[model samples]
Target: MTDPARSTVDLFAPDVAAEPYPVYRELRDAGPVVYLEKLGAYALTRYVDVRSALRDWETFGSAEGTAFNPAMNQNVQGVILTAEPPEHGALRSALLERLRLSSVRELAAWIQESADAMVVPLVDKGEFDVVTELARPFPAKIVGELIGLPPELTERFVLGSDAVFAAMGPMNARTEQALGVIADVLTTIGGITAADLAPGSMGEALYRAAERGEIPPEHVVKLLWNYAGPAFDTTIHAISNLIWALARDPAQFDVLREDPDLVPNAVDEGLRYEPTIQIWGRFCRTDVSFDGVVLPGGSRVAVLFGAANRDERHYPEPDRFDVGRNARDHLAFGYGMHRCTGASLAHLEIASVVRALTTRVRGLELGETRRHLNHTVRGFERLEVRLS
Candidate 1:
């Protein structure tokens, strides 16, 4: 019998947002769904509940926007994420056809190449801000170009990407500043053309889809948000922390250097242990029953993905960062219909970087790093790393 009114599980609470694991454990252990009056949202503390809500999109409508932002109604125009099926399926399919895993494999070498070129010089320097130098710029520029964005427009990509990702968080100074920048960025992408999309890339394909009426035209710009947004921020966050992860324990670094093939598993385990994207939101379209509690219609449900990844019920001693953890089914990339479309791409990108660092960079250690200030994302603002 736990009270939800004064519960520590409210993510909007400043302290909880900064550090939520203790609260997550409390909610998960006490019950399946915790009714939170303050967040005006329900908390899904268990893995099963989170999985079900993601799958049950019809019941958990994305049209109204997932977060508590009532303004998201006007703000979410044309983004495939806000559109329900037929339209959602069409837009998702069109974008998927472009960024499919098969397409990702085609760029694996390119990904490795990019990582090597960027990481080598930095590793040689022995120290650099992992966020500004590597994590932020590298992905912002590289992915922006690969997706058919021109070089001159890289600044828009960088600024907008920050805005959209930060917008995922609750209202705050960081989130406020980012929202204005993202609106402009989306407008720029929205103005681009299929011809300008740089033939055959995901961005170009999305415009083509819009023209073919495969997906809504408004959704095209959002595709940038959906595809590049997840791909860029999450990977950068993981890479930055990954250095933190391995460098924190030299034994682990030694293990990775000894065997390069473990890159994929190692990356997956890192995702599970310290996922960059901590929480994703969904809204109950109608009354939904789970854990013997009924989440009435219009309830805001905050799925504590960070908590689920560390759930001792699903994973043994989830706190430990064992590279061998069987995290295949982990919800780090989410689950069901909305599972991250860029999953393969992210893995390939991260794995390549991971392999390159272990093989090429001899010694690596953390110089300094700061957690990104945001309402949603939990990653580096600046990660200074020293490597030989």
Candidate 2:
């Protein structure tokens, strides 16, 4: 078979990370599987190929760890993100006790109330920075309360979550710095005991699960890390990006306002249009062929979630931001068993923000924005807006 297409795409470059859709389009156009020369990894840019790889986790194993760098891969071992088979299921089961759809649905009323409490005042203010005022604090509050994290420690965890994703990239200066932050965050988490957590909180529940032998006591901290690290960054970015999308397209916000029932669809479309997670790593366990292109054993494969979500072949008029579009199939939360355990919670949080905005704000006026560049995630660090 002909050699797989190769591209010199520097996905981690500041410029590329700032505005990656054009590069995503280029990667998708390259082929089903393109070799990324700079990273020494193969990229699955097409929706079909990406979905297939994510689904067939046995071939594209997570056991070796999902991050590109060896240190991160080793660091993430045994967590749900890296575990395979029976161990993965057991770990996931414990997590789902609180994160399942029914459980998440039960929290909707409180989530909506929290969103209103945070957003209504911001709306009344007329102008605010979406990142600091709404997006960041909203999730930080919700997740913090749920996890029983002390209010003072919330910001550190949020910063640590960013570091977690940042460290997943190549061992560059950024990754090195992120590693230091992660080490500090881990140390902080290690200090917490069952007594330190709030009664009936998710963090406390994890400790209880360990006590009951549902999961090992040793797994409690790593499981807590799983909950804390992922719960903020992706949802925070999603909320900000969704609002940014609506701000950029008033017509879409209008569409959402006309049909409040479309809030879930709006969230999905927003995730598809600009996935917070741009890429994730998978190690090829053995020689695997995708559309006649062979990925040799022991290869590092980059699963381009952002690219697949925007693949024109999978999403018609992929670039357009339509709140009514049914894009829930998007890879933003990934696919298959390894899909994000907190997806239900994320949807609830994002939908809560949408409901609050559509109810209270007539329109949104976009202002200056800045991108939050990280190795694997894409989002705005500062997003200013005026609500009318």
Candidate 3:
């Protein structure tokens, strides 16, 4: 039996954040559930436990707040990310009606064309920071255009979106700064009207839904606030992570070159291999037991997505960066009801970039990389690369 006394680990510690995989392996070996006194939550590490917890929203809830700290958990309410059931359904449907796979598929050609155009200039440049030049800017631009915002506003939109992801952690300096950014974003979103967006854009669609009483008028602002993070940050980091993976393993890039059909698989593997978001918070609404570990009602829990993705129980050779692996079931975008609403759109964007990169560049040479530090998400701040 594992020692229950040694279950706790400070997840927010810098060392763990910098390289979480090693710690994840240790946690998984410890047991399915580890009681983390530091964060006042039970940390679920094993793939089955984490996946089950996510789907059992009734037992492990998000309604109270999905952040580690009470302040954020409480303040983050009313947003789709924190809401439950009928409320969540309303908030999500408002946006998904337009962001659905069929609807987003219409943008596939544009996104591919855009990806090709963004990559063409860099192909000849030989060396470039993928984070700044391609991965970072492209998603923000695409999200802005989709939301009907002017291109100039994309930067601010991205900053605000970053804050959304950062605010998911415990109350700390990062959360403090993120609160300020979120406030500003809300103010900007509150002022926007359907007319401000393109004639038939997602932003316009949201407003039109509000007008039709499909969702609350107040929810229009919430919907706008919601799109910034999922639509921009996660997809941005996924693309960067994919590029890093291919560059780190040229054989994988060669695999892509040989069979462009694997671009979708490549995206899935990237998300599974190096998910952008590391951990997410959920609260127990009732006493829940998993693998003999009983979490009392009202207890907070951390779902370690990064760890679950690499769980040996679910994936053999999980650490290997193999694009051919069937990683479609990974928890990177989450699972069940709260699964990312923009999963299809994010996939489209990532696939477009992969397809374009494989067709254009022969290979990539890694340079110095600077990783971004956020309380919740994992990604690059600077990823230097040289194309051959």
- Candidate 2 per-residue lDDT over residues 1-388, each given as its tens digit: 5567999989999988888889989888877778999999999889999989999989999888889899999889878898888888988887898999999999999999999999878877899999989999999999999999988778889999999999999989999999999999999988889988899999999898789897788878898998898989999999999999999999999988889999999999999998999999999888878778787888999999999998999889999998878898989999987999999999999999989999988899989999887899888999999888
Q: How close is candidate 3 to the true structure, as a TM-score?
A: 0.96
Candidate lDDT scores, in order, read: 0.73, 0.90, 0.86
Residue 361 of model 1: what lDDT?
A: 70
Candidate 2 or 3, higher lDDT? 2
- Quote the positional error of residue 62 for candidate 2 in Å: 0.7
- lDDT string for model 1 (1-388, tens) is 3333234445756677666788788888867777765665777767778878888888877777755565544576556667887777876776677468987788888888988888778777777887787777666655776788787676677666556667766666666787788777767876777777678776787777779897678766677667665567777787776767887877777878887877788888888877777777787778777746677776777877888888888888887877766687888888867777778877877787778789977667777666775566677787777776
Clashes per model (N, Cα, C within 3 A): 2, 0, 0
Candidate 2 all-Cα RMSD: 1.0
- In candidate 1, stretches whose alpha carbon ends up further than 4 angstroms from where it belongs are 1-15, 172-174, 194-196, 207-225
**Which structure among the candidates has the greatest TM-score?**
2
What TM-score does each of the candidates earn? 0.90, 0.98, 0.96
Residue pairs with backbone atoms closer than 3 Å in model 2 (clashes): none
Candidate 3: which stretches are off by over 4 Å?
A: 1-5, 212-214
Give lDDT tens digits, candidate 3, residues 28-108.
Answer: 887777777788778888889888999888888888888877777776777888888888897787768878999999999
**Candidate 2 TM-score to native:** 0.98
Query: Distance from true position, residue 63, model 2, in Å?
Result: 1.1
